[model samples]
Target: MSFKEASKQRGLYLATVARNLRLSPHFVRLTVQGEDLERLPRHGYDQWFRLCLPTGDGPVDLNALPDQFGLAGYLKFKSSGLAQRVAVRNYTVRQHRPEVGEVDIDFVAHGDRGVAGPWAQRAQVGDQLALIDQGRGFSPAGESDFQLLVGDESAQPAILGILRDLPRAAQGLALIEVPEAADAQPVEAPEGFEVRWIDRSQSPARPGQAALAELRGLSLPDPPAVSAYLAGEQALVTGGRRHLVAAGWPKSKIEFVGYWRAGGAT
Candidate 1:
């Protein structure tokens, strides 16, 4: 579904960094707070938002941008000088406490490689930023089925959110790949659900390769209604989904997202 359609609440908001901490060797956690968060809706599963950072040693004028995100809004932003003076990216909502007007975002930090990563690494308290709520991407239909959630570190927060919000009786398997074993964190799910952490340090290539390989080799229970959610590098999502479809899983039952393209920021 489109972001507009999926979002329960939509708007442009200004926020300030409240806290920043290193969550692991590869992840950085930032707590952002703003009164605007009081109006942000929480759908409880895979909720995400668009972020905009000021560009080139100048402060961003968030009010100069469009209130919504779309082709028309994008065109406006593109034609305006704001586009050149702002850096934009997408991120998941790891935690939200609207009562206190705060939201937490987990960023996959790859040193100085990308815009958001580097910015997050140096982010300081009281730094202002912009966000546009895009709502959630994963919302499984009610049915009798075992769920499969898989992705690299970029997808970890979303997968963990899904696990935490899943029904107590839900049965599923979540495979998450990270740069190092230390990047793995606690994930809460049903008693019958299983969560596996795949360390990419064991391999020489990028992160998603290990997860994709595992999915290809895994054997599922017989005759179970399966709902699968896959995200991360483009190839992993495409390849894993292809494997599932080839194994007779219905396309409608699978939610696959390419969270980022390989070799560049996405």
Candidate 2:
């Protein structure tokens, strides 16, 4: 489903931290559990949600959260005083196990920097939170046969999830940028897909710059037969979209989202 349609979905799923693992120098994997998770839809590719984390010491009033975070709901949530106590962020599902009522989310840990990252780094087992499913965003054109995925660390989980769920015969190229080579994670992409890991530690450019550079130099398939997904840093998403469009990619075949900006909080 499109993100817009997903936003209309109504429900609040409360969960507790089940497991937290340091996947890499910059990545943390958190597994959360809730009986309500079994009822959450599994759309697979790039499935995301609004995570409501209690940041205040006061008792959490998860009931104050709106069913869907539309404009009206957001205003209601803000006026409820819940917004001040809760830190909400959008995150992608790394994996979901309905049988166990658990979902895994990956966070880019930067040593106490940013809201969700620090919280995730120190999150203890049984910690409480709420999630409002926002569904998947990767929708390839029906006639497209080739896929091009580009993103930095912030979009790693989403891009990897998309790669994993792609058809076995899918042909594509994924350009992923990380702080260091060690930050790269193993991905289960189709045999025909090529995954390129760009290390930012070796360069002086910003987070998504290297990936965008690689994207610019690559020789891609016919634009009409290709589906491109660009995300992560704002410049990369907008710049990549502009480049792809200028290179003849059909606007309808490209799906992009700026997960975060380089100089600002997500």
Candidate 3:
């Protein structure tokens, strides 16, 4: 399309669900498809997406989605709007393969309490999702002497993405504080990098908890520059970012994302 048309594009694209995958006992994968993915961005650790799915009855329908007041489309969709509108959840863009117009998002399943979690638990072929326009990347830019990535399942997808994109010679350390050993998934990283999974499945990840404490005690090598990216619960992000800054990582170099706030909207 012309640059004008592309530049005018607003809001996220509406992508239909192609399939679902149960990555592990605790997580699910929603594979979505759309033509908008043709010129998708190659965002590493910084990418995020909103996961919107049907909340009501049988075969999913796109015309039924809530959209701006357009009488014609409304008549077409509402008449057959058999699905109930539910909540919209945010998830990381784990992998986007534009070659096939498909993208994969990993969801942590915690039962019906979470809308997307349980929905994905029973997602079928041809399911529909109103995917919003893509979000900006989360990967650290420029050169860094050393970097750090930390989070739980909430951060795994982005963590894995970051690790996958890191140069094979890149140097860094990953302290993936996850729920138990089962939550620890195999990740690809540089030879000099070390990955440590802190098991805490028995309880929710608390603020200034075990992982943060451990991180504080460790000594890091000083270099020309260092950066860190953190995503997960709010308190952790706040404290983790503060600690890293105090530890010498330039605040500007740290990208801490509070994926979800505790007891409030994500």
Candidate 4:
């Protein structure tokens, strides 16, 4: 299904933080667990959700949250006065273990910047939050010879999740950009898939520039037989899409999302 169609089917799940780990200098992983998570669907590739995080020391009003974050639901949430106390943001599921009722989410924590990132950095066991599953974004509906995945640090979890869940025989190339080389994580991609990590710290370019440059330099297969997923910074998403389209790729074969804009709160 398309991302919008997938988002229409939703349910609110309340979970408590079980563990917090600093995976890298800029990455923090939060594992949340609850009985509600048992009902969460395993959509695999780039599965995301709207996360409701408490902004104050006060207890969160879980009942105030909507089952889905559509326009009507967002209006209801804002009218409930919960918007002022809760920060809602979209995040990708890094891992989910239904047997143990746990979901892992990775945040790009850069000190006290951003609502969810800082919250995750200081999140403790028992800290509460709510999630509304919006399903997966990467859907290879048509026949494709190979896949092309590209993103920056913010989209790392999603890209990695896609790689992990891809078929063992799938062949593709993933260009992932990160702030530092240390932020690169180990991937278990198919033998035919090449996962390239672009370290931004090694160059003076912006967050997604290095990856975009790499993308522009690649000799891609026939556009009609290639499925591409581009995400991360706003510039990268739009720029990558434009580049792909100009290179003879059909718009239908490319899936893109701007996870966040540079110089803006995520």
* RMSD, every candidate, angstroms: 1.9, 1.4, 6.1, 1.3
The regions of model 4 sitting more than 4 angstroms off are 141-144
Model 3 regions lying over 4 Å from their true place: 1-11, 56-86, 141-144, 202-208
Score residue 100 of candidate 2 by CA lDDT: 91
TM-score each candidate.
Answer: 0.94, 0.96, 0.78, 0.96
Question: Which residue pairs clash in candidate 4?
Answer: none
lDDT of 4 by residue, 207-255 (tens): 8989999999998888677889999999999999999999999998898
lDDT (Cα, tens digit) per residue for candidate 2, span 1-266 = 66657667677888999999999999999999999899888989999999999998868978678878877778888999888889889999999999999999999996766789899999999999999888788885453478899999999999999988988888889999999999899999989889999999999598899999999998877867788899899999999999999999998888889888877854
Q: Count the backbone clashes (under 3 Å) in each candidate.
A: 0, 0, 5, 0
lDDT of 3: 0.67
Residue 85's lDDT within candidate 1 is: 83
Error of 3 at 230 (Å): 1.0
CA lDDT, candidate 2, residue 110: 66
Task: Compose the digit string of candidate 1's lDDT tens values, residues 142-219.
Answer: 556889999999999999999988888888899999999999888778887899999888885766889999999999
Q: For residues 71-173, could you state the per-residue lDDT of candidate 3 as single tens digits?
A: 4433534565332453456777778888988888888776676577778788877767775444544554555468888776678888888888777777788
Write down the lDDT that model 1 would get. 0.85
Overall lDDT per candidate, in order of appearance: 0.85, 0.89, 0.67, 0.89
Off by over 4 Å in 2: none
